[model samples]
Target chain A: MDKKRKYPYFIENPLEHDRVRRFLDIFSAILETSNYRYILDLYSRVTMKCSRCASECQIYQATNDPKDIPCHRTSILLKIYKRHFTLGGWLKAKFTGGSGLTEKDIDEMLESYWNCTGCGRCVLYCPLGIDHRIILRLGRYILSEMGIVPKNLLVSTREQLQGETHNSSKVPLKALQNTVEFLEEEIEEIKGVKVKYPIDVYDAEYIFFTPVSDYLVEPDTLMGIACVLHEANISWTIGGTNCDGVNYGLFYSDSILGDVNRSLISELRRLRAKKILIGECGHAYRAIKDFLPTYNDGEKIEVVSIMELTLQLIEEGKIQLDKNVIKEKITYHDPCNIVRQNRGIEEPRKIIRSFINDFVELKSHGQYGLCCGGGGGTVAVDETNPYRMNVAGKMKAEEIKASGADIIITPCANCKKQIGELIQFNKLPMRHAGLHDLIFEAIIMKDGKKHGTDD
Target chain B: MAQMIDFFMKPFFIFSVSVMILGLLRLFIKTIIEIRRVIKTAGDKDFKYTKIFMATLSWIIPGKNTVNTAVVYSIVSFVFHIGLILVPVFLMEHIIIWKGAFGFGWPALGKQAADVLTVITILSGIILLGYRLFSKQRRKLSSVHDYLFLILILVIFISGYFLPKTYSPFNVQVNMLIHIVCGNLILIILPFTRLAHCILYPLLRLASAVAWHFPPNAGKELNKLLYGEENKKI
Candidate 1:
């Protein structure tokens, strides 16, 4: 119980009494009432046992277990859906005594669904285009309904939605003010420029939200973001009232995903901002951008990744880079969430290639890249760090090593954290950073001072 | 047996083929309704159907963007599907039956090509089944239905191949009965079983696009239903 005290969870509450019954009840309700039924119904019927997804799954490659096979793992739930919900399955069960949901299936699900990472590479290779990632998420969402979730993710989600501070990391508004002040001074000292992280400026063209943890731990990324935005003269503010963009809901529950976005969008509405900019968080960006189409009728504000904004600024000649600041060999790690969504892929690569002189690509990059193993809320689990490094993250780690790059520029907070863990545990000499972290180094002021040798 | 085959063939084909067409139509209509409901309920209906259409084509075509290891299997599946559909519709015997019944028929495959296609269909169908039975991973995912379905298709193809010959171990009538009966059974089960994938595959893609989507306030509604109040966290 003496784990990360930053987050709190009611793990014991889910398994309190008659859990199997509760699980089945929730599962049945979710299937019937929730929108997942259509997908589950369709995928359950069409999903093949061909093991095609195995070729693309990093988890399967490492463990070489049949259970690790994406389709096989997905089949576990699909079989249950058929056995319990569909007419054919019901007939078969009545005649043949087919199995139903049980404690053993629950145990396997608890282990398998969480470990999936939901990187979604396998979905692309699915012959039927059955993105089992969604199905796995459906499984997790059902488990979440039973209150079965990783403690850290649930705690963080709880805090974001209802904690003392309106952020996942539980950082108070006072701390954000202090971090901004500290970064303001740090920017003046480091870049010889006066950059401000404007707060609560209503009617600004853009409002920015980054992972609250990055606000505290990744000061360099914040500084790069601040300096770039300041130089670009883009009207933006960080809403101290609701300052985090990390949505763990996207990994587990649709309802939570919607609820969290509703809260964020409310902040945007409150500010009366025309556009919302997300910083260095793929799922957060996806939560707002991709999920918005399904959440609303595309009526409201525009959502853009900081990478997209930065790429635009670079193209418009609003931001200048020194290109020589990054001498180390560099590769970009495409976060599964960003690339899979197909929105944030090209921007980060373009931005990295613009200034990174010694840039290299991973063995598999773009939409086909391996996962950092911290996807699907796995990084928040913490106890599974070893497994992530060895099995889940192994393919990405090996690819990074083989790329022989000294630095891996990860554009998403989750990938940065997960790949950081991969490097730490794998004992790889290389380090990883957000694209903005390098942007902080290579950014030269437009029509202002260069990072001159005199300093 | 000849009398039975004659008596049943016309009505059986009519009934089963009608069921197949209407069943797939029902599935299609249901899919569109579900997609619209999910979107309309969510309040976000701005999906790019054009892009989805293009993407559907990519994966629907075997060997396009396939994983290196799955290339052979995908190609084999492609071949099996081609022969499965082509031989049934284009065989001279089938066209002759169609002409006899409807008083008109389209072009038919030459005997040599039809024989070759039938032989390949049976062979590839076996390989596909072999793939499922051989791998522990695949076998674990397989069900009795999976095995039975492939075996059923192989039976149809093998019997169809023997039907064209003048002589066989059990005579051509035995193969004729199997080809007719097995083909009818497939048509009957096509929509009920995973065999529906032949038509449902594209809708499977659209379902994936639209299905996991959340209706606005989806979480709030579920929470209130379960606990009488939406919690701070789900």
Candidate 2:
């Protein structure tokens, strides 16, 4: 039999200090220090609890568990806020059996908040414009402060923030250099020309940061990025230490999110790059693009996502694609961070459509697109694979199955991983890849020098 | 007894309405102060006023841009709000009361239309209360306050509906007093409870806009405050 599990099976809480008191203190500190209280104050009042979000929540839909309902999950925190923070709730509980913050409630949040992919699809359905993910993040942030973070997330973030390699993945300077050279070689083999993979080239126009995992696992994406940048004449550089764009901080801690983005921006300012160019990761783009300004000293350091840049390059006729290069029917998966938050709805689709004849749309596309379920850093947590594959992953799996496409092209690294996992778990026939992965396959090499011309 | 009831009606009505408006004003002022605070402190200060305004409008009128994802409840809730606001302010007798007290009244709603709206409000309130009560999901999120507020509104509506009917068990003065007092009671407590959603709902999106705008070095500040100098804790 599997060993009887202890409490907090989801995240690693050291239990060294008083967890309950730490939770309340952190919760109080957040309200006192930031504008977070304003949102909570308004949110605690405006929530209608109509169960409208249930119809849209994929996890809730698959599990058929009310606990999975975004409103219900959000209420776990909102209830605590009402009881402890607000006057009405305090009076009610004082007189009529109201309760305080409990260890059990924290456990419920530990279990529930991560279950959401932070999709914000439910925001579209909600009449009040309440983004459940914002509440979800607040819940996750408080828990992380209480030292109740998924070991996978906490470990990786700890490694990135404190370790010698200075990245979530412990890719050393030598390994990053090796990854760059490897991508250069792959680009040369694929395009019959040397694609520019610049490193520490001072005063470059842009600085590139992809998910560090992409450096290890996604050579084609790095190669594709190089080829596109080379063809577009966009000079870019990558810093060694802070090159990782994957911010798992967005999933849990605001401080970590800020620190990660701050580390990247520190690199950009050091390298004197015009803007930070993020590679194919959903939350990475959102973390940097959306939160960087807040995290940094109120300077909206410009961000150009690889997808947006590629689309710009394509739209400007700087680089062209040969549609005949790809034969499979392809469908696009809109990463929630990209579509719902960043409003990057059609940039990838427009790029894909320009290059493929058999481009298919899923049953629900764009802002209404479902989550890959492996979001919120759930992909990193080894214990959640079953939940990611079965509960949250099923809707997206069914969508891909229904689309009848041979390949799914999502520009998000997280979505690609989740979709990859879904296919393996469900024994599906289709393939999943990043948008850049397809671009590398289909991008016409420089000026009629075909991939095989010099081979 | 008539003079005492009249005295109770005028003074209590004036007091409740004043408290309701001032309370809402105070909260709204807090929201504005929050906006200014976020401007000074938050990361991104750009406010998408057009998008927020349009989105707010869509929710205000369900036939607009809400896109009907929660088709049944939203539409029902919209119908519910219609009479919940309109019938009290626009009904002829209510206007007559206002005119009697304040020496001015606007055009009153037709009696037939007012009754129709009143019944619709009561029915939809029942549906909403049922929606809250029956769903185990909803019940878990609800408070006794939520239940009591709904029942209070229902009481006021039921009493208002029965006010004109002479076949009632209670005398006319008794029925009128119940309607008057319950209406004032809701107004008095409106800002303190979730019912303050009435004033805060339209301005809701702005709070989110402000929340995402974090103060400069907020993370570091919070961590330092929580865990001493170094990033020692977690």
Candidate 3:
């Protein structure tokens, strides 16, 4: 007899009976009423056993586990969809029995889908053109409905949704005001130029939105934005309501994703801001720039990534850079959401080229770039960090090592955190900086002096 | 004996073809309606149709994104798919049968070409089956239905090849009957199984483009219907 592998999250501390029952009830109901029936139908009938997708998958490359294959991961959900929702499945259950959704199935779905980063890299290489990312999102939505999401994502999203701070980090108005004030003082001290971090300035040309991570952890990235915008003299203000651009819903729940996006739209209307300016976060840019038009109706608001703005500013000579300031070999870590999913492959490279003299490409760069192994909220969950370092992060760490770049420029916050951790874990002598971090360091201030030196 | 073969063969062929046509049509219409629904309500209004077509065209041609990574598998798969249609439609033996049924036949490939293409089809089927069985990931993803479809195709190819040339101890006529029966069964079942990829691939690819732009609030209407009215409005 073959020994069956155990999944602890499902089997060891199984969901309470009532919760499982409630989940089953709601899930079964969802099966009937949603477009999932169509999705299930398409998935069950469309996917074949070609195994072409395995060669390109980073997770499978790391673990060598068949289950980590993108197609195989989606297959777990497909099997459940077939068994529970299809006509043949119903008939089989009626006659042969024992093919219904079980607690184990729930566990397996969670394990397989969560392990995936919802990256579209596999889709790019799948012969069938199956968007396994969509299927993974549907899986995440299914799990979120059952209240079976990572506690961190859930808490942060809830705080962003219901809390007074209007952002995931629960940063209140006063805290945000203080952070801005502090950032202004720091900028004045360092650059010898007083720049204001504009907050809720009505009729501003752009309403800037960034991931709360920037506000909480990556303050330097925000400061860089302040310097560029101030030097360019662009009228922009970070929104006060739902100032955080990161929609955790895009990761876990479509409803929450919708809710968060809707909140942003409402904020935009309230601010009467002409355009939405998203900072250097990848998924946040994806959520507003890529996702908002799909979800909302008749919104004429123009959403632009700050990278694009910076590039435009460079072309217009609105900002000047001292290209000799940061003389270190640097490699750019492409965030999957931005580069592959959102067609942002060239913008960052263009910006990077203008500032760095010794830039090198990773073996797998641009559209073919390997993920930093921290996407799709993997960086948010604590339990998966070891896996990130040892298994998923293995290829990425090697890629970084082989590139031989002293500094790694990550435009996305998640990549910064995850790659930052991978650097530490692998004991690699790599430093993490935002793309704007380099720009901030290199840009000549209005006084025609570099930021750190006054000579 | 000939009458019995005719009795079993003609009806089976017609029934299988009818099921193949009708089943595929239903799938096509259902998928179309689903697309229209999504496109009308939830799709990105600014979605580029040219981009969708261009993306589809890129995937269809060799040396594109999908084929660049797994060159061998994609080449073999492309060759096998071409042989799949070519052998069945253009083989001399198949043309004779088509003429007998429809009173018309197109030009057929020479015997040598038919033999080579048949061999390619059979080999591809076997390779696909072997891959499915040997690769732990492929095996895990595959269902019995997936394996059965490959085996059925292999059986058809093998039995069909043997019908014209003698390799079996059994009667050639009996072997021909088995080949015809299996071929018909495949036609009947293809649209229902994962082999539906054969017919549904193009539409699904386009649908994926639409789905890529599928709205975040696309499920909002469904949520109301499923969970009852709760005002977590998007």
Candidate 4:
């Protein structure tokens, strides 16, 4: 294939082209100024070459390509940073091989930045203790300003910023009321308890928030949280208008990330709940748990992961689990956002352990857990880069095969869909379940009734 | 003879005094402040132990590159730095002045140990430079500054070795003048280059040690912080 034609493969839409142009313009301005020179000087003086960092890169090991090395990525950006930005680089550009940035440099950057998972695994391994994740994030920030982000990600983020929901399946005020009514009926039939799936309940002790995807695609997980909360007689209510827990701006851009977080924070504060319970979504949890703390400027608020809260209730004997609800041998896949990035390693495992008798841990658990391939909005971009879902899913498939478990229990929705598709595509004889599905199944009724099989 | 002694001793005494003052400033004042900043921010508890272990092992062992590459470079950097130090302080002529000034005297390692150590350190420095070129990983990450640093060290080491053992051609005065000027230039450049890592490493380790033990916030406080209790969406 011709190299010019190869460039088209990366640019899927005109918006991307425009965004790239905008980014180049801004960078061009920076390059023409003394500020750029100062930045280059600081960066050059601070950045160092370390030989011990070679073994730590996962992308390098996976691809066996030297270009995939974490330091190589830094070098690419650093070279551009030096060339147009420094006096030495300017002088050497004439004699040395240091050519300044062109349109091609931006294209290469777009491809490179998107490939990084921002896992911080390399940061852990770097002997110099450099945070390469910061470099990737800075690249993303520049890309965002250029408006060259992936289209599907951009649309969803725009929707989230406007409607407070990424999915069109959002439960608006009436739908939310109807769903609560429907859930109440289901609760009466199953648990034989009269519980209110209260909406906009003032002075509630807890405001239970979940992704809109849960209301449409996986109601069982949402219902599971409700059933557990109802059984424990905890005072909780779902938000009436902004029921979705997702923050799409976390992926699309950085400039809007603060605003996206502020919008979410405003909704949470409006509810006046003593505590906020985030549902079993990986990226959502990360946005709230990790990113929010950095952007929110030390704002004090109570945000607890649903898995953590469930484990707490089980440990306190506030809720009892009937083990027979899940009789199959189960293995847990730690979502990358929760386990590796946010250090939420044990909470999900504790919840799974409490309910499942035949639980087996995957070989690469906790900090070393592989990504579900659908993370960072890759799963949402079905129309573009569809192969990323499967290509990245390869490691996950191998991990599951090695576990020898019949069922895979993970806490994140994206992981569920990604792993579920992998199972279907590979024809693996294993089913996937959300952690809440098992938890809800194991919840004993108020009248002492147990559901599922008696093994 | 008196004129020659005065000419040699004046510059030697000035440069040596300057170096000693700078070393004292780095060791006593600047190092303490940097260490304090590192300790204040480090989240890990084991960082203190790791920092000491890595620093000590850097000199004792040969190729164990841990958190700080500067430590390894500094060890082999002895050729350039020690030659720079001793050529001013403990040279046969300078020792005579120290005895005159302080009324103190001691056994010096003499020229043999000095020459041997200088050769060993210089060879090690060259090996490190060569390693950067041959190692694909290092070469890819290396900047112009890195290459420049390696060349600078090579110049200092090679020139010092070739300069007259006693008095010789190339005008000992001119050679000594070049050595003093270049040595001072490197001293000024040290704090700004990757050489700054030598000062930053201990502090980084201390910070890492202290950062490890930070408490996991209670879910209640975290929940409020993450999703404000007032607005109910996220």
Residue-level lDDT tens digits of model 4 in A124-237: 445445556555655665565455566556665556655544333444677667777887777667666666777888778877666777776776677778878877878887
On residues B1-234, what C-alpha lDDT tens digit does candidate 4 reach at each position?
Answer: 445445444555456546645754564355456445433432222233655456444543444443233455445544445554554455554466566655675666577766675576567767777767887767766766787876776665555555656644566556555554555556656664566554455444333333222222211222244344422232
For each candidate in turn, the TM-score is 0.95, 0.95, 0.93, 0.71
DockQ of each: 0.63, 0.62, 0.52, 0.13
> What's the number of clashes in each of the models?
4, 2, 0, 32
First chain of model 4: TM-score?
A: 0.86
| Stretches > 4 Å off in candidate 4 | A1-21, A24-43, A49-54, A84-98, A164-196, A291-298, A383-391, A453-455, B1-139, B143-188, B201-234
- How much is the TM-score of the A chain of model 2? 0.95
Candidate 2, residues A1-455: lDDT per residue as tens digits?
Answer: 33333543455645554667888889999887767777777777778777788888899889888888888887788878888888888898889985588767766787788778778888777767777788899898988777677888887888788888888888898988987887788666667777767888888888988788998888878888888888898989988657888898787777888788878888888888888899998888888888887766666777989988999999999999987888999998888887875388878888988989998899888877898888778888878888889898999999999999999988887888889999999888999888888888888866536633565
Residue lDDT tens for model 3, B97-171:
666665788999999998899999898878878878987777877778788887888888888887777567658
Considering only chain B, report the TM-score of each candidate against the true chain B.
0.91, 0.91, 0.86, 0.57
Runs with alpha carbons beyond 4 Å of true place in candidate 2: A1-13, A87-90, A447-455, B1-5, B64-67, B165-171, B230-234
Write one digit per residue (lDDT tens) for candidate 1, span A233-258: 99998896897888887888877787
